[model samples]
Target: MSENWRLDPDRALPADAEIRKQARAIYDEIASLPLVSMHGHVDVDLFAANKPFRNPADLLIVPDHYLVRMLVSQGYTPAELGVPFTDNGGTVAGAEASDVETDSRVIWRRFCENWRLFRGTPTRYWLEHEFAEVFGLSAPPSAENADDLYDELTAALARPEFRPLALLDSMNVEILATTDSALAELDSHAELARTLGPDRIVPTFRPDSLLHVRHQSWAKEIAQLAEVSGIATDDYAGYIRALEQRRRAFVAAGARATDHGHVSADTTPLARTEAERIYTAALRGEATAAEADAFSAHMLFEMARMSTDDGLVMQLHPGVLRNHNARIHEKYGADKGFDIPTRVEFTRSLQPMLEEFGLSHDFRCIVFTTDETVYSRELAPLAGAYPSLRLGAPWWFLDSPEQMRRFRESAIETAGFYNTSGFVDDTRAFASIPARHDLARRIDAGYLGKLVAEGRLGPDEACETAIDLTYNLPRHAYARHERNA
Candidate 1:
């Protein structure tokens, strides 16, 4: 094994020599193309401030749920990994809160000591790429060299060239989008537009809180939405109007799409009278769990209706049971990596919305799922038939190399290439953006190469498909937002 932490030139490519050669050729064609990050959780304030990263631990470990969650699973507590606790009045127990690690070097040492835990994981690939390519680290992280690597990263972060916006430019990211709450004023995004051009950073409207009426925060979010839009949300019609107003505001502020993270793909709209009754019951805190589900389904359909009217692309990814661990959620809040996938059915769930707008030329919807089985069984056929529907790239847990290859294999037979939306990093870690996209491009190249080697596709056609997957698809999918920008 190599002693140094170095990335192989043909990493993640096919193992067969002939296929690898062809894949390398395809990868070279699109290696330096500008990135189109159309969906992610990176805070827009990172660009608005243009501040240097504080330290190695903060930059690499603290904010990333993927890293933190994996470490916690390996018997390391969040406090040990330098994750901040929620500001509650002594709610969590001793083991969860006692003697939290405060020094960045201490937290970094813990990470280096546990480096072997991530050996075959995609997290390791991304971290190693950031270490060697971004920070010029030649040696692999270990307990003995943890301090040295920390000093090196700290010094690198202190440089003005390593600031967030500078790193975005260095990474060749042309268009980046941040997920924003429905009630968000997008003041930071507005400032970013003036400073960095409107196309550089766009906001994606996410209304998950408003849709899940059973959630404890639904009423509060509705109040905030009413406050922001200056419209009454006491009735169903007024609430819909308020949401429409906010969507228009997002559009004016350079938003290209609206994202839904519902637990199911259900879009069955309820009758108007029934929906209004549910709305009133939800306001009175009298809704049953079933009623909440019904209301949420109807709201999703309503969102599709609004998208058709306003020309905003709709992006829906369902079947995630968010905050699966109640203890972790109470102590650390959401996105601490406790979300797990559930099986999802799309054909029947999405029928009502698709029947209404699937044939509309002006409307577009991209469907994503953690349930890989549905890719071939349901999502592929749906996207292939519906003009508005497009298959989103393998997302979240399925973002690995093997899963991505499986996605292409399964979806292409039915949906073909054009019916699929291109890659979106869907990341909160700023530095991992390029690494994730690079991995996707390499995997696509290998898939295309295999097809060419098997006499399934001509070399010319495979190369064109590679370019479309890397650059053209995302650009065209998001062209409407860019035009409005």
Candidate 2:
């Protein structure tokens, strides 16, 4: 049995000779295009600080939920892998809560030894590409070479050119839009923009935290928003004014879009009086869960209206049942790889808002779903009809190569290419950016190549579409061109 693996150039392409050759040609044409990461969750401070990555586990293992979730699925305690649990501080010995591992080497060892758990996964493909292309590793990580690889990565990271900003420059990133909360100060964004110009590093406004009235942090976020935006928030109108003011601030800091992550796609509106009543109840810490849902849905409709006025692209990602394992969440905090995908309905859920602004010149909405079942039935038909809507690339659980191919086969017949938002990395793991984009480019090229081999599209046209998908589409979808216009 082989413990080591190497990435083949034709990986993620078709198996047939003619199709593979055509795919390679298409991929090669756009392989050198600078990545336009229109939307992501990367820490903007990583660039602003310009710090060198400290160690192998820190760079590859700690920040990646993909790797963490897999290892955790295999019955590994997150503590065993050095993942920090929720830091509430009192530890009962022999309990998982207080068992945070401090030694980085131990975590690296655990990850390398069980590396096979990542097989047949996008996490594996990304690691292969990172190991081979990014880090120049001759072989895959394993228990035997783990120590040696760690030493090598530590040494490489110490070099001046391996700093975060330098790595981004070397990766040929044309632009990177990071998600920032509505209450953020944006000091880091400003600093980074000065380092690489306004186009290279930008922010995306995310206000979901402040939108849900029943959330534990909702009132706190609203107060912070009022302080941040210099607006009074004693009522719903002022609260909205504070949010709108925050959006304006984000745009001034180079944000081109606003991100909303909800459990459902519903955007139904409530009357003004009902919205005000819900807001007051929420501020008083008495809003019911059902009332909170109605208020959140109304805020979504309001956000769409705000986008129509302000020209910020609206990105909606719904249908994630976050923190399914209450036990894990209680000990490890939220976003600890326990989030699961649920089916989402876009046609009905979005009809209320779409009927108002579906064809508006200033409005654009990009909708993402983990529900692959809707790609053909609801998402495709909706995007095909509404000038305001575009289908987001397959995300979260559906971002693997096979799933990506399935997405193309499912949506292309109805939504086609331009009706989609192109490929969105939507990742928080910073180093994985290039590998993710490369994987997407290859998958898209393979799909187009099959079309060419079947006489549905010409070779030249395939190349053009490849370029469009790689560079042009994202830039257009995210409104990067009109940053100051």
- Score every model by TM-score: 0.97, 0.96
How accurate locally is residue 157 in candidate 1, as Cα lDDT from 0 to 100?
Answer: 95
lDDT of 1: 0.90
Could you tell me the TM-score of candidate 1? 0.97
lDDT of 2 by residue, 1-485 (tens): 24354678899999989999999999999998999998888889888888888788888898889999899889888777777777556553336454777688889989989988888999998888888788777578899988877877788889987898888888888899999989999999988777678888899999998999877678778888889999999898899899889988988888899999999889999999999999999989999999999988999999999998778999999999998988777677777788989878888889999999998877899999898999999999999999999999998889999889999999989988999998999888888999999999999999999999999999999999999988888888987424346
Question: How would you encode candidate 1's per-residue C-alpha lDDT over 1-485 as one tens digit per residue?
Answer: 13466679999999999999989999999899999999999988888888899899988999888888888999998878888777566436554455567799999999999899888888888888888887777588898889989988898999988999999989999999999999999999989998888789999999999988889799999999899999999998899999999999999998899999999899999999999999999999999999999999999999999988888899999999999998778777788888999999999999999999989877889999999999999999999999899999998999999999999999999999999999999999999999999999999999999999999999889999999999999988877743354
Q: Relative to the unseen true structure, what is the C-alpha lDDT of residue 418 in candidate 1, on a scale of 0 to 100?
A: 98
Candidate 2: where are CA atoms >4 Å away? Answer: 1-6, 88-98, 481-484
In candidate 1, residue 484 scores what lDDT? 53
lDDT of each: 0.90, 0.88
Which pairs, if any, clash in model 1? Answer: none
